[model samples]
Target: MIAFEPTEDQRLMQDAVAEFAKATLLPRTRELEHARGVSEDIRRTAHEMGLGLVSVPEAAGGQGQGLVTTVLIEEELGAADAAAAFGLAGPGAFGRAVIELGGPERAAELLAGFAEEGGWDRFGAVAWSEPAPCRTHEGFATKAERTDEGYRITGKKAFVGNAALADRFVVFAQVEPERGWGGIGAFVVRRDNAGIRVGERHKTLGLDAASFGEVVLEGAVVRDADRLLGDGGEEGFTRAALRFFVKHALVVAARAVGLSRFAFELAREHCDTRVAFGKPIGHFQAVAFTLADRAMDVETSRWLVWKAAAAWDAGQSERDALLASARAAAHAFEATMRTADDCVQLFGGSGFIRDLVAEKLMRDAKQLMLAAPTAEQLDQLASAIELGQKLDPALVLPTPDTQAIFT
Candidate 1:
């Protein structure tokens, strides 16, 4: 009974993003890779196209696209370059959380600034990961104690994505040492906030252009207005945080699917033209079958991502099952990576060289696994299924008007 066909509007949206990615993004991959940072031109083009603000609701002065649309755009950009796609998509995710969780005045102020600026120089990076025992915010060593002036935050968060250029971070800290994540609440910490410091940029095997660093807070002071959703001492912030985590996970999955497809096409082209034994190598069963399997995996991952996004967009509370969709995607992505590596092997030595596109594609393919919860963490997500627990509540966003904030 479910319809899989995308509407006319959806198709148009998808094509538009794909065109932008090919025309504006692909050409810049090498430049970004070498520069090790985002390019102003790419950012400007994304801002002009409204891609930087895609997830912001229309009321918030953005395109108001849902996760499905976001992923579609993400796929195109990711096919071109993962870091650039992330630079475009990560901010939108941050803005969405702000609109849903921050105070009205603060949210309006920030959203207005975002609209005026076209796009933020730094992307929105959520600082949630902490050292052991507090993994996933279940417990945290960071503390944000209420003070006479506001709150004094003291904690350290590691490996925050986009931390280098992030203007502000959504940070989780405990008000009571006894509360753990339950006692945990979120606050907005600005780059210049007292005692807030961004640490050394780290290099990774892939997504080289994507900025990763640490956020340190030592006696950092933030005003009360900066407190997110549950500042009134409720679990709303935790709810909002989980929703975003799940959404980011989906974005990662989409990027994996896109890059895999890109690799498949490249392999196919090689097979058709590269003569082997006086004929195209594609005639060989090994190469042909591998490509076919890779295509199957890519298509399957794409389907799961689309379904997951649609579920979230429709406000379906049953969307928790979509976590399974994310895991399926991770597996498919792994398969595609292996296939792409094999395809590169099919290319002989050309695949290992710098001029060949397959080499870069292989590098980017490895990056998809590290995005967000990582493949290992995503695999743990399936544990809920084993425990006979539902993932639905994990996917739902908290309705803003359902509770009184400063009451």
Candidate 2:
């Protein structure tokens, strides 16, 4: 039987995160936007709440929560501040990739740091997007060459989240240029590496508080032990990448739903109090209908997000999970953007100002829309799956570049 209600533990977790969002994230949203970064104190508080370790298994010193729980937390956080939610959840992607593909010994060694007193003081990032115009279809331009010691990676990754602040980066590179994504592999590159360069920050449309930039690797040497799927070759890497992508898509969908809900609430409140023709604007059919439509959109998107998250937790097939997540993300992105626009309309001139959050919600919605596996791409993927076409293993899976939004 299908269940829409959250478990007791899940409800408790949701409430806790909701309270934190109201108490911390909401009040700081404007400050962080102005600063263009989340404070270290906020980051530490997030870690202390176990947001960073939500994806890690209990045996690995994490809470062992599933994707559904993580999405629930993300929704609440995103409602308060999208960038802060992204910052808090960003490290989980890297940590999960390590646990899934790096073997138990590697997972133990790397995750141990997360258990330290401060709790993940250093940010984690994945470098996957390339500066090349054909990056989307052609895959990464970065190359990883086999070496006696391990591998030498040389390439530039564009639009990497946390590039300026990440202490560790999970970089993706092709071992054989001719093979494209089939030759891709993932390697852990520390920020302190001699040949690695963190580039200037990129000013984005939204998620302003989260750092986004480029990472350049010029003959950076990586030890064999640092390779996530050492000796498992491209096949192993591709499989792990797909799993990560599906998980990330679901989380992004959740954020969209949250942001849309926030916009809807703002619009609803404005409609209720604002006077028009000697009465509340909400009494007008034109205004009331838009709010009603937005309410429907937000509700629909929320359910879709939950369904995708639930499929993942239920151990559904990768194709099924991916399809669900892709569909949810694409729809949620559209819905949220529309809702944000309607919110702006409801607020009239005030909505356009920075003081009003409606404008910010619209900006944030656009960022989510453009984030990884864009709506158009996701629709195509869904159509391809429906027709039983074989997906390009790498194309369907999330790349370091494509999956950066979830971070």
Candidate 3:
């Protein structure tokens, strides 16, 4: 039978990450927000704490943790500060992808530096979004033209996580337009390459510490050896991309659950302390019911997040994984936003100000909603799965008003 409780090692890992997040990430929230990026000291501390290598395989000099453990760690870190968690988790996700999909030599090269003695000093990124009318999976305008030497990639990717500081980027581009989604390929390009340019950071509503920005490939050339999955062709590329997207969706869901839990706890504590008419606000029926509703929402979302992570760790079929992830993403998004809004409401006037963290959590929840595979899109994917339709993994339903929003 499947178990809901974490294993002994998993429990220990969760506790350790929770402690580290509270001690390190929570204390620096204000500073990190002002800086618009996590400090080098905070990054190094995360590395030393082994947070950067939790998901990398043991063969690659990492802890060899599974997706479930990674989700647990992410939940705690996100509870402390979602933006800080993203900064630390982003490279680990890239490292894991390389280990799983990149060819032997490519994996060795990337994993070697990732396992460096000092820390995971080298940043890695994945560029998938592009400047195009269609931002869905089939809408990628970036083209990879074959040449005698290798391939020349030309396009601009917007909203690239960790772009400003990334040393390596796994760029997605179309290699065979006639083949549609199957024609897409992921090519590894170095930041210092001849035509690669990292754009200025974009001012976002939240998750500022993630350093989200643009990456431009003006005919950036790379040899065949640089391609993830090398000669595996379109099928291989599609498989790798789908797996990564599913895993990423689950992680984002876990983060949302964590943020929701954090907001609920803060609101609960505030309700107990803030008194009105000689009694604590929590004693009031309206305040008590709101807190109760949010507590239930947080618990429900947490279970959904764990269910998706557990499905992934069990090696379920791709369709099953996608369905679980989509459900989790949709539920987590709604729950987190509702809980955050309730938190602000509970705080009354203080929540609107910067002194309290309720407003910050609300902003972070909104930013997460805008991230890839939005709640509406995930809901569509889930609906397709239920109907036994094998929809394109990158295909997102477009509404008239939201058509341009994805780009």
Candidate number achieving the greatest lDDT relative to the actual structure: 2
Q: Write down the lDDT of every candidate, Cα atoms only.
A: 0.68, 0.79, 0.77
Residue-level lDDT for 184 in candidate 3: 70
The digit string of per-residue lDDT tens for model 2 on 1-407 reads 95588899999999999999989999989898889888888888887888878877666677878888988988998888877776663355567667666766786677666756666476678776766633534456788899998999998887787788778888888777777667678899998899899987889999888778889999999998778873376666665676665566667778788899899999999999999889999999999999999999998888888888888889999789878887888898899899999999999999989988889999998888755556766786687778887677555654444443434
- Arrange candidates by TM-score, descending: 2, 3, 1
Runs in model 3 with CA error above 4 Å? 103-108, 134-138, 229-236, 393-407
User: After superposing candidate 1, which stretches have Cα over 4 Å from the reference?
Assistant: 99-109, 118-122, 131-138, 230-238, 318-325, 332-336, 390-407
Per-residue lDDT for 159-268 in model 1, tens only? 57777787777877777666544566778888888689887766766777777677789999988877786334344555455556567777777887788877888888
Clashes of each: 2, 3, 0
RMSD from true fold, candidate 2 = 2.6
TM-score of each: 0.86, 0.92, 0.91
- Distance from true location, Cα of 286 in model 1, Å: 1.7
Least accurate 10 contiguous residues by lDDT in model 3: 398-407
Better of 1 and 2 by TM-score: 2
Task: Note the residue pairs that clash in candidate 3.
Answer: none
**Candidate 1 vs candidate 3, lDDT winner:** 3
Find the candidate with the highest TM-score and give its number: 2
Name the weakest run of 10 consecutive residues (lDDT summed) in model 2.
398-407
Worst 10 residues of 1 by lDDT: 398-407
